[model samples]
Target: MPYIKKDFIERLIDRVDIVDVIGARLTLKRSGSSYMCCCPFHNEKTPSFSVSQQKQFYNCFGCHKSGNVLGFIMDYDQLSFPEAVEQLAKEAGVQVEYEESAGHAPEKKEREVDFYDILERAALLFEAELPRHPEALKYLHDRGLSDDTLRRYHVGFAPESWDYLIKNLAGDNQKILKAMTDLGLVNQGQQGKVYDTFRNRVIIPIRDKRGRTIAFGGRVLDNSKPKYINSRESPVYKKGHELFNLDAIRNLRDKNLPYIMITEGYMDVIALEQAGIHNAVASLGTATTPEQMNLLFKQADRIIFCYDGDAAGRNAAWHALNTALPALSDDKQLQFCFLPPEHDPDTLVRSQGAKAMLDYLEHAESLPEYIIATLRNQYNVDDEGGRINCIDRAAEILSLMPDAILTRAAVEKRLADLVGWSQEGLHGSIDDSIEKLRARKAVRGPESTGAGGSGSRMDPNTIPLNPMRAVVARLVKDPELMRAIPEPDKLVAVLREYANDRCQVLLDLMGKIKANPDTTTGALLEKYRDSGKIGDLISLLAARSDAAIEEEGFVEIKIIDLMHYIKAILQEHLTARKQALRIKGRREGGLSNEELIEVQFLETATRQLQPSRKS
Candidate 1:
């Protein structure tokens, strides 16, 4: 097989449970919401190796080794990344799809072997030559890179001589020379002459997700004209799709951090990693692309783009935001962090420390905030014409967001507040804008349409209805009760209708419980400990635990009743919205075509939700 397809790996991983995988190898005793065993990698009397079934991850607190199932397999079984993947696929009883078929694989395999071998060999040569160059060694050392960091990243130096790589690696072999040229290690000049492409520069190899060296980036040692020289795009390397240090960051066990830090260059990633921030990656010396954004999303649910707090950086960030519009979803988050004018990620981390860098990242401007701020700076919201312009521009951008009801509604509400427009009026205008966007896209060509949903809530309805809050609290007391919730998607849709803070937490908690059937209350509490709501969760459980103790199976029964109540509320809300639309149609002459369709959808949904409880 050439390489295992990414989607196949993802599916295979999703099928296999971490508890089963680790329990089969090591005796895991239940410990709260996780399992515990003495770490196989380290000698310790205490069990420091903890496995979170909910997270599908393992961490050895003693030895500092932590990763997901695939990572554990790689470390424990002494297997390569591909071997671990194969092992999991076999256990999961799934067929692994390669990028190439067996009949056509041999040629591709040979090319891959040759290409990777050449890149690796070139990296080794540069590594060996680094110690011989005092200036290069000093430059890295002075910049706070330790011996371990340098070795870990495989940092190297390409000698000043133009023929260093060609003379050592390619020699007089025509095939080898051609391969090197194709790989961008050597370049062909005037009159068929050839020389090393990265002469007298610091070489850092860029590896793929599989940890295979595919390309190199070289930065100059002095104040040179072009400060950096990266390998030209070759068959093995595509710039837009790859992020520097991605292979390293993927090994992180807690990859689901609230946000992943996205930097602008290799050194920034390297510096951040060296500073004890392992959850960061760089966009490879270019504006972040849609493909890059998608890749980041696959790794984590959120991203915070870090850039200099300058005009150029703002421009670059604006481009990234526009590129990311199509990929926005209610489940995903995007933020931006603009650094001080004098510093990039590298300098900031070095000057202040990791804590400072993290503080900045944690407080980055969210996507909606950034959008509104950018518009506010560009337009005079006080003037009618300017406010109208802001509304129009906001509609165009907001319309590009995936048609998720709650997220769109939340953002549109913000826009409405800013432009002093009634929610009804703004909704109508945005619906029209959505149509125009689709019509224009239709004229151009076929493109993927996003999921759609309705937004806003009942005017007199108080959020976190006693039933909703009770359900969440009881689920916290007995997480398995989450399985009793029928039509979870619809349930989430209903919770999102309110868009309250408590509802957000409820939505996230319900999602986690649904994801893991074996979810325990302790594990649930652990997940929220850092969310600053642990005290509230504990209080909720304390206040409601007696009812569960007084009656057996009360939690599950109560959960079902609450779910019915929530759905009934949804039915009522939809009816009210539908009636409101009709009244607006009569008052404002007639509803738009989109509003007419929405009215019909609401009617159907409300009818379907007509109280089915047997009580």
Candidate 2:
């Protein structure tokens, strides 16, 4: 891949509106010189996060977290450095420009620069092929899809001929051939030859949030076990990360909407669209993934899972809900809507008009209600033993949801009244089960938002206390001040014990700031966002203390004094360690070579760093 020019990045940053970007995720109130919001990074009742439009930066009075537009997005959306830049650039409507650096290695598909263009051409090819296939068109028409709907969705077809696409779209160009293969549109056989991946099927284009055609799904004409086959995971397209018709609904997506409808197939999504329900999309031939759910929550406040009424549909709904439960935020909602037995969205919409389908969604069962009802159906609650079993099952599933959905107190009171068990007894039993569930799921990884990004239920006690809060807060809020201190290496050594989370990030950051004197705080933070808990730890530290001296000119003087204090602390630690080791060696037999070397080195390093003390 070509190197993205720093000039392009600088221009992109200059072009974006900080308020617009930050305001999208949060509500910002205008103050005298800045905007303020309750910092999303931490749990705070009072507003402390401040964004200064004049300086093109932000600093929290409570957390001391600070950066420009990119940093805010990286924190808010859990996006990596390049991802944030591209997203902001897209919002700003500025094209990303790249250049080749000398001796830089090219990506495998680097020469194939027109991946999106090729995908568009393939989509059009399928469209052009559809008109000739009367049987394919008839199948769609029989499903009650109007010509206008067909055109709007860009639904298409593929012929059974082995080399139809290869001959039509890919000629003699090896680069185009590789691009097609990369997209999984062309499959390689035993003889090292390529053949069309989709054949004798109705083609549906799968798109990204950006509306780009990243992959395709094809439905078989004849009855088959796997009625529909989708494109394999490619560089640009992963089934778990995308949804069918997401491109259609994304523009119509309104965050204020109570919930967006999630369907199981492309046809269902198109059916919903034809019925004038614009806030509906479907996962691409796979179970809904946490990443896709994260993307969905970014657009809407709630999600409604619409499944078929058959046993298969019920299983699909449960699988989706279970996969999505850990990622659900307290503020968001999820619901379920089922069609009649043997009925799917396409058939249901065709049989009864859009209004009838809308009625089902309008009265969709909420998650908690469904959980209770499903529990009752699964366990016989007429006896004492049955009630206990039912409660245990409920706890397992409910543990996946956050306290926002159903609190332990609410569960206790509700279960005691409903199940005829003592409130205290039931609460204690359920708490034990839920703790087991959390322990089992501790390693499943975090959700795609906030500082932790791990959407596991947050507890205030989990955040560590910052003993050197002021020094650490200054580094994050005003990174350039690190250079002003004469003893950064010693300062880091002294403060490492306090930063239990990704302390090496602090060390790496200081080194980078020292190397490139011109690196901005936002750029510096972006470099280490994915290294570990660096960004989260900094955000936590920022939330721990108020920004004492966040102003530009005055920060250096403050750092100079702080550095001397930290250096003195480092000396004390070193002297104390040496004395302890010496005493230990004398007590035992004599000094081990390693222990003696460490003591001597610490003493010498302490002497060298001592002379530059501010006093």
Candidate 1 lDDT tens digits, 1-615 = 377776676666667888999898889999866799997654468997888776565666554455567767766654556778888888788877888767768866546438788899999999999999999999999899999999999999998899988888878887788889888888887888888899889999999866889999999888886999899999788899789977776665233355688888999989988999988889877788877776676566688999999999999888998888777665678899999999999999999999999899888998878887898898898999998888888888877776764667877888888888899999999888778877877877755211100111112112344545656666665566667776778668755763444466667777878877675543454345334444344323422323343345465567766667566556656777788899999999999999999888887888787855796
In the range 279-378, model 2's lDDT, one tens digit per residue, is 8888877888988887777666678999988888888888888888876665567889988887888788878988989899988987766777677777
TM-score of 1: 0.59
Candidate 1 clashing pairs?
Answer: none
The candidate that achieves the highest TM-score relative to the unseen native structure? 2
Q: Each prediction's TM-score against the native?
A: 0.59, 0.77
Q: Report RMSD (Å) for each prediction in the order shown.
A: 14.7, 6.1
* Residue 564 of model 2, lDDT score: 58
Candidate 1: RMSD over Cα atoms? 14.7
